[model samples]
Target chain A: MMSNLLLLSLAVLAAAILGCLYRLLKGPTVPDRIAALDTIGVLLLSMIAVLCMLFRTTAYLDIILVIGILTFIGTTALTRYIERGVIIEDGDAEDDR
Target chain B: MIGEMAIGAVVLLGACIGAISAFGLIRLPDIYLRSHAATKSATVGVLLILAAAFLYFLLYLDHVSVKLLLGIVFVFLTAPVAGHLTGRAAYRSGVSLWKGSVRDDLKQEDSSAQGPL
Candidate 1:
């Protein structure tokens, strides 16, 4: 039963990845594409958790946590860049080149 | 036997809901509408699957798995935050709502206003 459920969840996650791919390709604006990327991150984390249970391993949880944090930071940085035209300081990029 | 059946039902239900969410994501007309379906449904689906995992470990295997529970809790807290931030960021960047969208709350914010008269 557990195995069956694990398989079902994986299939759904795959479908989500496909949906996200469509959005990433068709997104009308930069932010829309960013949202799709964020969705992909969440779906990936969920998939990892489900797979961890099926395989009886706790090791994957660490990867999920790290990926979740990194994805959040990356999305936030992208958002900052889109909204303000800059995220990090080159210091002199604000002046020339 | 009962535990096994319960796990199966929960897993299948989660999968169904997840599939529905993906369908909604594709079929919805605009980014905001698709987001509404994606965030809520996907979160629920993940919660359901995590609950199944919790039950499987606790009941069938007779093991108390702290990591599984922690993962579930982390997902519950972060999913909404991530979705909300993504939506707000999209709005802030001028991704227009669908043509017929009504009563946009974000538009009322002063900083969202455009150039001088």
Candidate 2:
């Protein structure tokens, strides 16, 4: 029963990710794409958590942390780029508006 | 037996929330509204699934999983920050709001006064 539930949840998360992927591809704006990507990251995180439970092992626990950190950084950097047109900013640059 | 069922129910609920949030992401009128669905409810869904994982290990194996606890905190803290950044980027980059959006309080605040310092 436990494995069945975990597998079901995993499937649902996968389907959700596919939905987000559609938005990522079809979004009219850069930020729209970024938001869909962010949603996908969160869905992937939950999916991994479910996978861990289904297998009854702790090995994937660190992966959960790594994926979360990467997602946050990726989203933040992308948004920064969209806002400033650069991933890193140096003071006194004229392009910053 | 009951504990396992509890975990299953929690995981099921998280899955449902994830599906709903994703649906909102695709169906919403524009970027801002999509961010609303993507970040808030998606964050909750991830949190619940992580919590369920924590419950499963704690109840079944009597092992304490620090990483799951950390993940819960990490998602809870950062998802909103990411959403806010995305929204700001979208607005500043001039992604127009849905026509049906009645008002933009951010726009009501003078753009000149809010220019980057």
Candidate 3:
């Protein structure tokens, strides 16, 4: 019973990912896509959490941290890009020839 | 028996919340509202799912997982900040609100920043 429920929820989360993908593909603006991507990242975390539970192993836990960090960096960079047209800018750009 | 049922229930609830949030993401009219659904709902759903996994390992295997604890904390700290940055960047980049919505506190604040005409 427990395993069945886990499997069912896994399927549901997968469906949720597909729904977010629709938004990713159809979003009218850049931020809309960014938002969807962020949401997808969170959902992916949930899916992995469930996966490790099903497999009953601690080994996959590291992957969760890696994904979370990557997602954070990606979202921050994307937002920075949209806000200022660049993810990184030199403080002394005026001095640089 | 009760433990297994509880874990299953938590996992299912989390998945359902995720699906609802994703549906809202697809159906909402504008980026602001879509992100509202995406960030808030999705974050809660993920937290619940992670908590369920934590409970499963603790009760079934008789083991403690510090990494899951760290993940829960990490996600709790970061998801809202990511959402806020996305919304702010959207507004700064001139993304329009849905036509039906009326409140824009940011726009008011922006106008108020200027000297009286």
State which candidate has the highest TM-score: 2
Q: Which residue pairs collide, candidate 2?
A: none
- TM-scores, all candidates, are 0.81, 0.94, 0.92
Model 1: how far residue A73 lies from native, Å: 2.6
Cα-based lDDT for every prediction: 0.73, 0.89, 0.88
Report the lDDT tens digits of candidate 3 across residue range B1-117: 888988988999999999999999999899888888988899889999989988888988887888889999999999889989999898888887889987878777766784221
Report the lDDT of model 2 for residue A91.
69
Against the native chain B, each candidate's TM-score is 0.88, 0.92, 0.89
Weakest lDDT window of 10 consecutive positions for candidate 2 chain B:
B108-117
- Please write out the lDDT profile of model 2 over residues A1-97, one tens digit for every residue: 8788878888888999999999999989999999999889889988989889888899999999999999999999999988877898776776735
Off by over 4 Å in 1: A88-97, B105-117
Q: Among all windows of ten consecutive residues in candidate 1 chain A, which has the lowest summed lDDT?
A: A88-97
lDDT of 3 at B78: 95
lDDT digits (tens) for residues B1-117 of candidate 1: 766777767877876777777777777877777778767887787788777777777876677777767767776787677667667667766777888887866566534565211
Sort by TM-score, top down from the best: 2, 3, 1
Model 3 stretches astray by more than 4 angstroms: A92-97, B111-117
